[model samples]
Every structure is written in C-alpha cells, then in structure tokens.
Target chain A: MDEEYDAIVLGTGLKECILSGMLSVSGKKVLHIDRNQYYGGDCASITPLEELFKRFGAPSPDETYGRGRDWNVDLIPKFLMANGLLVKLLIHTGVTRYLEFKSVEGSYVYKGGKISKVPVDQKEALASDLMGMFEKRRFRNFLMFVQDVREDDPRTWKDLDPNTTTTQQLYNKFGIDKNTQDFTGHALALYRDDEYLNDPAVQTVRRIKLYSDSLARYGKSPYLYPMYGLGELPQGFARLSAIYGGTYMLDKPVDEIVIENGRAVGIRSGNEVARCKQVYCDPSYVVDRIKKTGRVIRCICLMDHPIPNTRDALSTQIIIPQKQVNRRSDIYVSQVSYTHQVAAKGWFIAMVSTTVETDEPEAEIKPGLDLLGPVKQKFVIVSDYFEPTDNGLESQIFISTSYDATTHFETTCLDVLDIFKRGTGEDFDFSKVKLELGEEEQ
Target chain B: MASVKIPEQKVILCGEFGVGKSSLFRRYAFNTFVASNSRQSTLGLDHINKEYTVNGKVIKLQLWDTGGMERVASITSSYYKFAEAAILVFALDNPASFHVLSQHLLDIVTYAENAKIFLCGNKLDLVGQVPQVTDADMENFCEQCHNLISATFRTSCKSGEGVEQMFAEIARHLVNANRSRMELQTVDKNSFKVTPPEDPTEEPACLC
Candidate 1:
C-alpha cells in the first residue's frame, strides 16, 4: 500500500499510539506502521484466554459460574484523564469495549504434591498476608521513618533528595526486620538497583513520591493483569489507530531509516519505500539501531499447565532473585491465560535473561525444564517452540537479544514452549505439541 | 554585519520528575490541568511556547521542560545553556527530591549565575496528607538551599490553586530581570550589544 500523511509514526506501541491518536484527533493525517505482522508491539494479545481455556479441556458453561469484571478499572480512569480525546473517541466507537479478558479458574499447588483451587480474592489474600507481617511496632516505626524522610514539599530541584541513606542503610537506620527489608528490597530492585539509588535524599524522596502517587492515584500499588490476556491493550490501540485513519502494515519491517540532508525523511522496508517526516521508535531500539549503544537479552518459556506454586491465578508476576541463578541468568515469571473468564487450560510464561556467551541459538530448551520438586510438582522445561504449529506438534524455541522482542512474541511458539517447560518437567515430551518458529519480517 | 535581536525575556521550568513542572506551565498558559504519569523519560528536551503581554508589550516566553534523571543529565543540560529565568519545582510531599534543589540550583548557577530563579513547592492540595509546608517553612528551606535562589511559592496543579499567582510572579521577575540587564548593558564600558562570543578553541559550555 502507498500513502502520504502530515505525520508518520513508525511504532504502534503505547506512547506512539497516544501521540498518533492525539495528532489525528487534531486533524492531522497520520500513518502508523509496525514491523511485526501484529499491532501492540509488546502489548498485543493473540491466544484469546477463552479459546485457550476450551482447548485445555475446560468444562461446559453450566459447570462454571461467575461474571468477569473489568480488571483495568483503576488504569482506565488515569488513562482517560491523561489522554482525554483519545479515550472519548475510544469509548464512543466501542473500541475500548473490544479489549477483553477471561477470568479463568485458579489453583494453588500445596505441599505433598497437592493442588487446590485458589480463592477469587487471592491477590487481596497475598497483600493482607504481606501487610500483616509488618504489624509489629518495630516495623511500624520503620515505616514512620520512611514516611518522615519522604516528607518534603518539593516543587523545585532543591526540595527533594533522599539519597543520604542507601536503601540498605535506610533499612538499617529504621531497624526494619530482615524479612520486610528483603521483600521491599526485592520490589525496589524490579525498578532500580543500588547503583541508581546513590543520590542524595532529594532524588530518593522523588522516586518514593512518584511511586506513592502511582499507588494512591491509580491504585496501581498491586499491579494486576487484564482479565482476558495481555494482548488487549495493544489491540485496543491498534483499533483506535484504525478508526483515526491510520494504517498498520504487519510483516513489513523497515530495513533502514532513510535520512537526507541530516534529517529523517523516510524508511526502506525490503523492496518498498515508506516516506515519513518524523519517527518515534521505542528508545532502546533507536539506541541500538541508530545510536548503537547498550544491549539486552530476553528469554521466555510457555507451558500447557499452570505453574505449580501459583494456583492458576491471573495477574501474578514473580521477580526471581538475581543471586538465585547463575550470573548469566535473571528470570521472571508470569502466568498468561489464567485470569480470563474462559475455560481454557492455564499456561505459564517465564522470561529468563541471558547474555550472548551463555545463550544458545539452536539448543534444545526442553531438557532444562524441571519440576519444582518439594515446592510443587509442576512440570518445568524449556522448549524451542509451542504446540499446534509445526506438523508434529513439536516446540520451536528462540533467543532474543532484547526484552521488546521476547514480549512481542509472548504468545507465539517461543513463549508457549518456555511456559510449558517451566510448568511441566524437562522430560515431558512435546512430540504432540505443535510448534513453529516466528518469521523475521523485512 | 547583519544585526540580530534577542527576545528580552524568557522563563524556564526545572524540577525532578512528576513535580508538576509541566502542570504549572499548562495551568498558566492554557488554564488546564492535564495530569500525566511518568512513562518514558523525556528524550533530549521539550519546548513549549507562550505569549504573555507584559507592561503593555507582547513578550514571548519560551518554556523548556528538562528531564531530571541523572542518566539523561547530559542531554538535559544542553537545553539549559540559553535559559534566562529558571523556575525550580519541588514537591511538598517528597522531601528528598526537595533537598536536591540545592545541587540543581548550583548546576544552573554554574551555567548562568545571573539567571532569575524561582523555587516552587507544588502539590499544595496534598499538604494535609503530607507534612504541612508553610510559607515560613519554605522561606527557611530556600535560605538553606542557597541565598542566590530565594523566591519561593506553594502551588497545586490539581485544584488550579496558586498557579496563576505563581506565573504572575514569574512574569514580574522576568520583566524586572530584563530591565536590570538592559540598564547594565547601557552603562557598561563594553559594547551595549554584547554578542555571545563564538570561540572555536573553547570547549562547548556544559548546560547542566
């Protein structure tokens, strides 16, 4: 397809989606394209949880009872307030309503190889349990100190900087218990580490304040996943882009950014040339392809069954300790297709980080999957591919050098195979699971 | 040589992330409160233009919002070199971020010592939830931050409170600073029109 426009956005991710939606609403002709065949980049959903549930041998409708509610309630309001026009148009056109997820049955793996159903309020249960541990006076005192250090009315640079105490030192000063300190430290590590936290109290306080605001204003303190699948978000944005007369051409990866006279003029994709005046790529991609600085690695695993410890519940993201694995591996796990209201069998997704040296491009990942043993009898293996794709239902595994790439293929053979391996044992043969490798578009 | 004219006045907003720097500008320029969460860090810089009628003369003010993260300090500093007036934003609820205002002010002073600077404590609506920050309290905080960066205000972008007064104060400061610069230029023995000397030999000035 050939097109011309006032503005052309290269990526259809969240930021670009919002930017393009606003610009189009303001009467600007816009063209948005994604190199991948699908929209939403990392945020796109493919395996509809409802379908996945049925495939997993879920009982008929009469056997299960309960209505699925919108899980993005808190996020919706903030998104609306921040992107008003885009939100309004989305609701008016029924685009936002199309974004849906299924709330699936959850099960918890207990000791002695036992698996039990998880309560619907599992998240609340976890939070209450975690909060209960801090009920002691000493913990309360530490919380108070944290609150005190955070208590500045910062409107300028001078007003905020709480870096005087390292997180480790701050915990020490507050006399927080080891367990609470460990948990909080783990949570902080998800966002940043000690090196980034070495500033004065001002920067520290600012970081805390931002977290507090996100918690209070958006109720995002305990993050939750969409009920249906992770893909709804990007799909919604793609729908919005379409309504705004934006074009999304998948399988057309731009090979090179066409620059003329020191200005970005367009891009060349295979045998086609798409012209544009401006380009907004995810910062990391721009840094890599354009600036050529920094690198990242992403590994994903998908399983047919739910992860043993996490009773088939939706919205759980496990942050593994960096010290627990080898220096080359940093793994995080999440359960996909678990929360959807569908009866699809649950699936597990695990992302492991690996550097170029330790990672293999064509290694059989299934052998690495193992059961958690005493923790839970969940099968855990790494497969190269997911089921139902290749002729023999074999798994096809892939290794990516970027987090964005892994997220982009979260539902494909690579992710599904990884999840299956993590939930099932490495010896579990996927000879029956059809899998295929994702194509590289250019 | 062709003659060039420089805008006699300008104001810049500087602060840590999520401190209502953008909110303050939006409130003053468009009378709107567009609440936004920190998503991606601001790349390089952001420029917003507004025309304010001061002293019966239409004066154009260019407001630049710079990122606060240390990783992007180099990129943000590049935008700071040309600023004439700097509005330093701090959050009342976040004391640690406020404490860093001194170092930020030092950065600005190192680049342009004579630039007019205003310290603003935002999120006044959260004063009760947060520890209360009184006018006297801010005065003392400013004194400790640095004597050179003294003017301060408590504003909230949420309730549209104090936003107007804050901008009015900024406008008043810029007008006064422009007058002082003009008077100094007229009286100085050096050329009244002091052009920024371009020296290829000198290292490029670090903005941050």
Candidate 2:
C-alpha cells in the first residue's frame, strides 16, 4: 500500500481502464480502484438476468427467461465501429487477444415511419430504396466525391476547399436532397443533431469516409460487438493493465483524493494512503470538478424477436434522426441477441437511448419502443451526463466524461484520446504501440 | 514464440493476501521460490501459460493470480468469468485463512457458477512446527463446503512438496471433465494473429 505509483485511477470504467492500461504499458506504475465489487463501473453488463432486474428494482424474472446465466445485459450498451478508434486502440494495446468480436448484422436508419439500411458506399447508394432513382445517382456521386476527397491531395478536393467548405456547401454541390442529407448526416456520420452541417465539411467528409471504409472491411455494417457483452471491454483492458504491472482494487472505498497546493498527490482509502503522482477517474468521483451538461435516458428492452424491418438481424444498430422523430436529439436503438451470447436463445436485447430534452423521458423513447413491436421486459435509466470543468493541469486529476447517448464508441474514443493528451501532456502515438503476442513467463 | 496451439483454460488462484497464492503460482510456473522477494518478481507476470500433459493429452492452463487485490474482497467479478477451475488457497499456518474458505467458496459459486473448486492448504513445510490449522480443521471446512470441492491438496513452495502433484491433479480432472469440449476445439484450432491483413480500404499515398 505504501508503494508510490505514477497514476491512481479511481474507477474501473472503460475510459479509466484504457488509460490505466496504456500508462502501465508505457512503464508507468498505476493503481486502479473502484467502489463497486464488479468491474465496468457505470457501463457494467449485468449477468444472470436476475441481477439486472434487481438493479432496476423490477420483479424477479420468471422461468420464461430461461437460464439466468445465459443473459448478459449491458447497462450502457455501445457498439464499436469496425474501423473506429476504439478497435484500433484494442489492437494497438494487444487487448484484442483476450476477447472475441462478432460483426454487427446491419446498420439501419428510421425514415418515413420505416427502418431501412443506410447506404454508405457507391453501390449501396445506387441500390438504396430510401432515395429516388435520381437522388440515388446524385448520392452515389456524392459518395464517390467523398471517397476521392483526400486531406493531403489537392487534386482530390474537386475544386472545393476542404478546410473552407461547410457541410451545407458540400451537400449543395452534389444536389443531395433533404432526406438524403438527413440519413447521411445521422446514420453514416452519426451526428447527434444538425449542428455539424453548419461547421466545416472536412470532419464530416472524413467521418463518412471512415464509415464507408469500416463497411468495406466487414461487408455488413461498420459496427462490431464483443462476444459476451460490452463488459468484456473494460475487463480486457484491466487484464492488459494487470499484465503490465498495474494493480487493481475493487470494492474498496476511496475516502479522499489527497491534494497538495492544488495538485493531486495520492489517494486516502481509510487509515492507509497510497501515494501517486497523478489521479484519473470518472466524473462521478470528482463531482465538484464536473458540470452536468445534460441527461441521457436509456431503455433496455428484452424482446423475443429481432427489430422489425431489419431482415431479422441478430445484431444491428438503428438511428432515428432528430427531424424524423421531430426532436432536438436523435433516438438510437441498438439490438443484440444470442448470436453474440448476450441473451438467452431466441431472446434479443434492444436498447433505446437519447439525450433527455423533455420532462417525460420514457415518452421521448416511444418512437424507439414502437419499433420493437413487443417487448418481454423493459428497464429505463436516466443518467446525468457530466463533463470536467477542471482539467488535469492544475489539479493533476483527469476525469472522463459520462457515457453519451450515441450507440457507437466514436465519441467515447475521442474522450479517451483527449483525456490521454491532457493527463500526459503528450499526444497518443499510435505507431509506438506494437501488436505483439501475449508474453508468457518462461 | 509460435508454438503448437492447445486448449486454453482460465484457472484463477483465489485467497487472502500473503497466502502464498502467487508463490504457489511462481513455484509451479517458474519452478522457483524466493521467500523475501516473492511478490516483486511475479508482479510483472499477469498469468502463467503453462502446458501440462494430462492422460497423454496436452492442455494449456492459464494460471491467473489475484495480484494481492483480494485482500479486501477487491477482486473484480470479471476475474471469475469463464474460469474453468478456481484454486482456493489457504495458509496451513493460519486458521483465519482456513476459516474464510467458506466465504471464498461462496464467491466462486456465485460468480463462476460452474468453476470446479480445488482446496489448497499451502505452506506445508510449516506443518512440522506445531501447526495452527490442523487436519481436522481442513476436514471440517471441506465438510461444510460439501460436494462442491472437486479435490484438495497440501503443498509447500519452500520444500516444493506436493506442488507438482496439485497442479497435475487439477489438469487431470479438467482433462477428464472437458474431454469432449477439447476434442471440439481440436477440430477448429486457432493461433494468435495480432494484425489484420493490409487494410485494403486504406487511402492511397498522397503528398501534402
């Protein structure tokens, strides 16, 4: 307990676990602790089907749910994009070996009161039913243009300045209709709202290109889910940390974060004080340093059938754009079934989450619920999303933001990278991380 | 480092802090024991990947340690997931560790659900000096756990007595228990591959 460490992480959340693993791999001694007995902190996946019901204060599950151990229900479910930064980080850190992944069955979007597959590439654009014959060609040309626009090559810019052109301008150049822009913006780019349309088009172009590139990698959707549940992710990183000599403590209460001269020195857990140079934790640990930005409402629905109009995909992601649902925020529905081993046989778990903009949080996700046809059980959770008001420079305490309403881990990865930079005062170098095999004691 | 692939079973070592779980792990995996510097050398190793031949069949057992994180019941439930066997170690010189065996058994059955429990009374060399935990204590603890424990072993990392036999017994039981599952894995074997094939979707070279 007296050994000094480079960093003391306060939660076992995915972001904190990843940072701890990375730091440990870089040869920095780290100590990670959590108050809860289980891992995954705020984003843990409850198992046995009974625990989830108990956590939500719902009635105990009857025998109809089948074997209790067969279900792994994630509290804050998120899908990882195949070409997303998170997957790249997994491979980079060599955590991929500890876990397995299955590609998501499809990526669909809700439009015209119906769900349809999002057209990412030129081929999908031409064959898409969401668009008219003329709009399809236009959207295809748009996709082709996006594929060609390179950040380094001026010739691929098509006379439009990548830096100066707004997303609205990019849309107008290809004559992409309103509906085309809606699905393209919400589904492919995964924008929470239309705010990005007013910003520079370079980021949007890169996002859509990323979406297409990820789709090209797997041929289905760009998303990938772990075999068991999202719970495996944090544990995978924790194991990586442990292998790299990072210590972990769970079910241990962290009484106080010792701060000296406005900089973190260590953590005080009872009578013992474990010293560290810096501290990393989730927003909940340092509530005074965090500001509540908004609340996200999520409904975990247990169903016997796959999401309607999804071709009976075993796992899929569906986004209901803000405009279609006539809301300020988009509603995201992510479905996973027994194929991924997250549910009992013939049982599917669909989660509908979004930023809470109204008083009736349950009513806000009604559109997402209506898409599920019939649900066996539902657990609703409304959690406040927090962001750090104080960065690590002064306090020497880096805090990760709360999980957002997005179904993908893109934003989560961005937060991780940002926190890494702020905590270490250096950018995360991808090239330095070798995809080495698991080392063994000889 | 590329070796013949075998079935990997995750076997976790659970006990109180300083119960010589890591020492037992080191004695078996590295086959060396350091009384004073036991914890330092093993901190760098997450789990030991040891290949054992049970009934003429090779099985790779991933022996995992608690990293002394279980001292305050701080070990994560993730550590129990997918575990095929759990080695519940206790110090024969300390009756307290023996008394807490029921609590550890409760945790194993609660989290692991299906992991075969193997009771281990470590520090067997200390038994020569008036033993604090007698054989009756072990028998009583086993009776309380009742039908849950697969087998029991007494070993000392110092004298290396019964150390090899304990692991062999574990491997033999696991091989017998999961023969069909191992055969199924033999039909579809896979070695580790870290990198994906040259990502074809990667953009072409472009000079700024």
Candidate 3:
C-alpha cells in the first residue's frame, strides 16, 4: 500500500487524532505516526508493576497487592467531545460500547508534615476554612469572586487577566483571608502556577471563573482525575482513530519533517518516507521539535505498601513549601495511586518536581524515599528529565538528577537522604533502594 | 429536453466560541461528525449547497457557517446580509455566552428583518451539569428582549440529539420559501428562465 496521503499527523496524541480525523472526514486521505512504540504518548499505560515484580521476585497482585481491582477512566467523555476524529472513529469502528468511565471522589491537603484527608464535597468549605486561618480579607474575596464566575460561557477579554500581582496584592484588593489565599495558591500550583492567568486582569478573571464554574458544574470540585488512570483518556481516542479509515503507525520515529518552501509536505521516519499534506503535533513535543526551547521533567515513584495511617484510601496532595527547592519555588508532590490494578497490592506514589535540572549526572544526584507512613510498604523512585540532544534519533535526553544540585554530585544523594529523614520522620534504609538511569523511550 | 425550475433558500449558523457551529453544518450537509473547537478560528466563510425536490420541482438550500468568534460585531454583520434563516447557538453550561445570545439575534434582525431564526443550545450531554434552557426561559428571555424568533432545540453533537429536527425545520422553511419565491416570479412574466445550480459538494473550498 502507498504511504502517501492527503494529510499526515506527526504525533499520535489527542490533538493529532482530532486534526487527522477531521481532515479525513472531509474526504482527505490521512496518516498518523508516533515515535513511541505505543500511541498514547504521555497518556500511554504499561504494566510497570509486572516488570518490577519480575525484577524483585515478588508475589503476584493476588498473592501480594490486594486493593481495588477496578480501574475507571474518567475524562473520556470530555476528550471525545474535544476531538472530532475520535467521534468519527467510534462510529466507523462500532467500538462505542467500549467507551465507559466512572467518577471517584477524593481530596488531600498538606499539614503537620503529612497529607491530611478531606471530604471531596467539603473541599470548598475546607478551602474556606483554610482562608479563615489567614488574616487576609482580599484573598477570601478573590476566592468567592472566582467561585461566582460562570465557566461554561465564552470568556471575553474582560474575564481572565492575571496582572493582579502577588497573592498578597490580590488578597488586599479582594479582602480575602489568608487561609483562602493558601488554598487558592496551592490550587493554582496544581494547575501549573497560574500559566493561564498571565493574561490581563479581565482575562484572568474569566479563566478563574471558567475554572470555578467547570468545577461546580462537573462536581469535580477542587480536583479531578481519570476514573482508571490518565492513560485511558488518550487510549480511547487512539482506538477511535484507528477504527476510522485513518492509519496510526507506532514505534516508527520520524527522523525529519520534510519541509518544502514554508509549508510541511511529508516526514522521514527511520528508512521510510511517509507523505501527507498537513501535520499537527502534540503541544509539549512542539517546543523542541517545532519551536526548540522549552523543557519538561517528570518523576514517578512506586511504593510497595500504602502510605501509613490515612483514613481515606484515595486522596492526592499538592505540596507548596514556605521556601524554595533548588532555588526554584516550593516542591510539588502528588500521590498518584493508593491501590490500583496496575500496582502490586501495595500503594504507589508518583511525585513530580520540575525544579530539578535535566542535564545533571545520575551519580551526582542523591535519591531518597521519604515515607510519612501511617502505613508501611516497599518504595521505588523513578526520575526522568528531558533536554535537547544533538542526535536526530535521540530527540531529547532523560537523566536522573541529584535531589539537591548545590552539593557535590557524590554527596547530593546524602543530602536527599537527610531531607527525606527530616521531612518524613521515617527511618528508611537507603541501602535497600536501587538507583539506575537510562534513556526513557518517548 | 425538459428542465425543472428550482427555488432558492438561504440558511445561516451563528454562535459563541466553541459552540458546535462547524459540527452542525457537517451533520446537516454530509451526515457526518466534524470535530471543532473555539481555539482554531475559522479563516473565512463556508458555503454548502444542498438540493431537495418539492412539488415535482427541485429546490436549493445554501447553508452558510459564519465565524463564531470573529470580532463579534464584524462577522455577524457581514453574515446577516443574505441570510434568510439563522441558527443562533448558545452553550447551556456557559451562562455568560448564553447571555450574549441577544446581541447575535439583534445582528440578524437588523440586517435580515424577515429571516427565520432558531435558538439552539449545544452540548446537551452536559445538561446534567447545566440544566436544559427550557422553552419558557427562552420565551421569557425573548419576550423581554422583544425578539420574536422561530424555534429552539437542545442539541448534543456527540449523541446526535436534536440534529435531524433542526435540519428538517430549516429544510421545510426553505422549501416553503422557495415555493413562494417561484410563485411570485411566475406572476412576473418578463423574468428570465432560471436554471438549477450544480451540486455544492463539488467545490473544494466549500467544505471548509
């Protein structure tokens, strides 16, 4: 079969699927390819637990990890509606029945050196309570104001401007309390440090209103997650894309974008040359591959046992310290899963810190697992950072950096061990933890 | 060779950003789903030609999709000129956008005084979160605004809800308008003999 087509989508992510699906539905022949062996990209799911169990000679999930076996893929509906191609694929492939997701409720807040469980329905109330602890009225008012903004509407220029200044300034102007400010501040961090709010005040207000409204409307409240895992959301889209006449090629990395004048004509993947008319890339990969500047680092940690002593089984936390980590802002830690089908009957926590430098050597970096257990279990840490590389095939380098870069590389690991010791009050044996670094496949 | 006389009808789609304007067009014209978002702005205007038979004669209905977020006042102003019928979409979850429905309706009324206007709320699947905008609410809103429009439908492009009803309403209105135009033209004996237009799908740029 000829590899030539009317349009070629560069990445097999959510956005790529939509662009390719729309063009194909419009009668344009389309082809989609991804560098990763799997199609979902960031949303890809693999049985890492099985691999880890094999390495450790551990018992199977039934014999060891026994918690929630059912996985719910939330956000599937929103993703389908957002992309056009997925809808067409569902209809063409008769796979609509496979699309299902369930909503789960959970919440967490960091206090007294550990994450405290909070009621999902009462998160706003808890936020309000937190606001009361701080003596700032303006911050309180800002939270109330955001709560009042309508999200479902098409926000105008007057809605979402972020030039409002420091959290203190916003608090003063709005007459909000300190507790509310901290809660709002922490929420802002979770949404990636007010990136969307960097607009004008009006635009900022609009986005805050939209965010608030979506929360209220969806019953998503302060936070939400995919029912099963994040991966299921994009996986559904990939399935639909293939059901249509569109073709998705995985494990075939595109070597170069065959650009012709100013427009893209085709791409060279390994030895194969796939041709198309238009190409759409996933937004993250766009920076280095398309724009060439921005960088991203993600860390995943798997624990053999659940964190100790939480009343609720499933609550996630977003930690913002009073000070900086490595000269950056506060450290951001999130507990991804307590117990799920993918992990051995034990609990797993995935903490991601963007502050760690990507280029640092693994030997120089210290690795430590700080367990704040009300419960005890085995723990594993996996840190990956991305930086632009020279090789066309490599694209980016993923390295494990020292937890603290200021100290000598060899001593950095010891600093991390000390930080976790002071932070968690748990006597963890670092000798048992294994640290390894390698290239992370895209 | 005998030739059939075809009547002409005009239909227009209007809505706020992200409300499924392009999806509605694809649904009505091609019986297919066209995924669309507010982020990617519509470059220009889209015109689709559709044909149907009425009273033993052929009739043509031209479906036009106007930009949803075009410096609002400008895009709507240009679209109203030739529009004989309009679909004004409002998002139910977004009350702010729904509030702007009056501005769009007024634009159409100012330009095409006699145009048939239909108010539709897209994303009916999200209705559980955002309650359906009842006919009474629309009636009260329209009464206060003094805009006596045509019909309203709660639609979900995802579930294919209210899509057929919307297209049927427009088709029926257009067919009737065509019959009236042909009758009026027939009375003017000096009018030139008209020929039916070719299929619209044949045009490359017509789809976008």
| Highest DockQ against the true fold, candidate | 2
Docking level for model 3: incorrect
lDDT of 3 at A154: 38
Error of 3 at A408 (Å): 34
Which ten-residue region of model 1 chain A has the weakest summed lDDT? A70-79
lDDT minimum window of 10 residues, candidate 2 chain B: B188-197
Can you write out model 3's per-residue Cα lDDT over A82-189, one digit (the tens) per residue? 112233333332223223322223334444444443323334444533434433344444545554444344352124333444434444466554444444444432
| Deviation (Å) of A368 in candidate 2 | 0.8
lDDT of 2 by residue, A1-442 (tens): 7789999999998999899888887778988899988888877888889999998898999988888888889989798877788888988877776677777888899998998887655566667789999888787788778777777788899999878989999999999999989998999888999999999999998888778767766657788888778998998888778767788788889899999999999999899899999999998788789999999999999999999889999888999999998999899999999877688889999999999999999999999899999898998999999999998889999999999998888888899989989988888876655534235334
Q: What is the TM-score of chain B in candidate 3?
A: 0.74
Descending-DockQ candidate ranking: 2, 3, 1
Query: What CAPRI class is candidate 1?
Result: incorrect
How many clashes show up per model? 92, 0, 52
Please report, as a residue range, the 10-residue window in candidate 3 chain A with the lowest summed lDDT: A433-442
Question: For model 2, how does the per-residue alpha-carbon lDDT over B77-187 read when each residue is reduced to its tens digit?
Answer: 667766899999999988898888788888799778879999999998887667888877777777887778899899999989999899888999999999887667656
Q: What are the Cα lDDT values of the candidates?
A: 0.43, 0.83, 0.46
Clashing pairs in 2: none
Q: TM per model? A: 0.41, 0.88, 0.45
